[model samples]
Target: MEITMYDTLLQLPLFQGLCKNDFTNIIGKVKLHFRKYNADDIIVEQGAPCTQLIFLLNGEITSQATDNQHSYSLFETFGSPFVIEPYSLFGMQTNYTATYKARTNINIVTIDKLFVLNELNNYEIFRLNYLNILSNRAQVAYEKLWNSHIGNTEEKILNFLVLRSMKPEGKKILKIKMEDLASLIDETRINVSKVLNDLQEQGLVQLSRKAISIPALEKLTEKNK
Candidate 1:
C-alpha cells in the first residue's frame, strides 16, 4: 500500500499516538508549509528567530553548534521523521540553538508557533509527546555538559562510550571512525587512538577498521563512576 503524508507524520514522536482523525483535525486547523532542500542547503542558522515547528519528513540533516572558542561541533544527525528543536519555539529568546544543514535532498513540514500552541491546548497526546521529546533532548544536553568537565582523556573516552552505548541501537557497537570520534570529543586522532589501544588491552573494547565494539558496556560505565 502507498503510504500518505499522514502515515509518515504518524510515525514521528510528536504524532506517534495520534490517530488518523486527529491528524485530519490538525491538517484542517493548521497551514503546513512544505519545503524541499538540496544537499548542503542551510535549513536554519544558529540564533535565527524560530517561528515554526519544523518536522523532517525525508532524508538527513546535520545540526552543528559553535563553542566559546568559535569552533563548530557536530551536535546531531537526524535521519527519520522527527521534530527539530521544539524547545526553540518558546522562551523569551526564541532562536535556533544550532545551525541545521541538509546532508542530502530533504523534505520538511512546518507549522506556525501559534497553531502549534493551539494544538497543544487541544490535544493532550501531542502535549505529552512534545514534553517527552523535550525532556530527552535536555538529558542529552546535560550529558554533553557533564562530559566537558572531565579533564582526563581516558575518562572522557570512557564517558563518551558510556553515553553512546546507552542508546538502544548502540548497545554493543559504536560505528564511527577514529577521526570523527576525535572531532566529537575535541581531541586529536592520535590521542583517541591511544586511548582505544589502552581500552583494547584492558579488554573493555574491540577495535576494528571502522567500528569499536564494547565487550562489556558495564566495564566502561563503571569507570565513569
Candidate 2:
C-alpha cells in the first residue's frame, strides 16, 4: 500500500519551523486521514490505549475529568498536534486520567506509533526532538497541576498572568472569562468572581462584561509574592 503525504501536517506547531525536507520525509511515512466530529464527540477516551500519535490537523480538543466533588474541565480548546499522552508511545500501562473530545469538526493525521518509535530510536536528531517535545509538555502539565493545588487565590491569579506573559505576544490583552480562570485555578466560578472583584478594587485586574484584563501584571505578581 502506498502512503500519501500531506502539507497540512507542516502547519501544526509541532512540525512548524522544521525544515521542509525534514517534514516531508516524516510525512512520507505517515498515514493521512480527515476525521470529522461534532461538538462533544469523543476523540480519545480515558483508559483507551494510544495506538497512534494523532496529529490534530484542525479544530479543538477538550480534556475533562470528574473528581468526587465536581467535574473539572481541564481544557476548553487546545490546538492541534497536542499529544493526548506521550507515555503511550513508551508502552506505559497507566490508564488515561482525562477524556478528550472534539469541540468542533476535527481533522487529524495519525502516524503509526511503532513506526515513529523505530525510526526515532535509530535517528539521533529525531530522538532529541521527540524527547524535547515530551519534556516541555510534561513541564506545562506539572505547572498547571501544581499551581491549582498549592497557591493562594491571589497567587494563583498572578501565576496565570505571568504564564501567559511567557508565551509569544505576552503583552497583548488577555480577555478570559471568569469560568476559565476558575477552572485553571481549581476554584468555583463564584469564588473566582469574588477574587476578581477584590483584584479590581485593589487595581490588580480590570473587569468588564465578558472580559477580565490584567493591566499591571508585574505589580500583581510582586504583591502576591
Candidate 3:
C-alpha cells in the first residue's frame, strides 16, 4: 500500500512537531519499502550489517538476542516508526546487535545509511534530531545491559515482563513457555520453573499446565520496584 508523505511524518515520533512541507522534504529523501513476511520470519539477523534506518508502517516486530548458543527475546514486540538501532546509522558499528523478526505482516520505510549521512551533512536540524534519537537508544541499551549483568534473575524476569505488558493487548496472561522465559532470564528451565512456582505460591501469578497468568499485575510490578 502506498502512503502519503504527510501520513509518513505523522507516524514518526521524531517528526511530530514538523510542518507539512518539512515532512514533504524528508519523505522525498526517504525511500519507502514494503516487506510481507509469514509468522516467525527473521527480518534481520544478529551480527549482520545494519544498512538502513527503518520506520515500521504496519504489523508487529520483535527483537531477540543471542550470545553464541543461548538466545533470548529482547522485546516482545515493536510497532510503527520505531528505529531499529539508531547508533549504527552514524557509522559506529554496522552489525545488528539483536535479531528482529516479524510476529505479523510488516511494512517498513527505509533510509539508507549513505542517504542519512548525506542529508545530515547539509541539514543541521535533521542531524541533531537523528543524533538525539541515537543517544536515547544507546542509553536504553546500556540500561538493559546493566540490568542483565548485575540484577538478579527474578528482577530481570520481572523487568522484562513489565516492558512486554506495555504492548497492545499485552496483559497478565503470558502464553510464553518456560524455555522462552529461561532464555530471557538467562536461567535453566528448572530454575525458571522454580522461581515461577515461587511467584505463583505468593499469589503474584497463576501457572497452569499450559499458560501462566498474572493475577495481580501490581504485585508483579512491586517486585520490580
Tell me, by lDDT, which candidate is best.
Answer: 1
lDDT of 3 by residue, 70-93 (tens): 332334466666767666554657
Candidates in order, TM-scores: namely: 0.69, 0.59, 0.67
Clashing pairs in 2: none
Q: Using TM-score as the measure, name the better of candidate 2 and candidate 3.
A: 3
Q: Which residue window of length 10 is worst by lDDT in model 2?
A: 164-173
**Cα deviation of 132, candidate 3, in Å:** 2.2
- Pairwise lDDT winner, candidates 2 and 3: 3
True-structure lDDT of candidate 2 = 0.61
Name the candidate that leads on TM-score: 1
Native-referenced Cα lDDT, model 3: 0.65
Model 3 clash pairs are: none
Question: For residues 139-175, what per-residue lDDT tens digits would candidate 1 score against the true structure?
Answer: 8867766775376777777666545332322235556
lDDT of each: 0.75, 0.61, 0.65
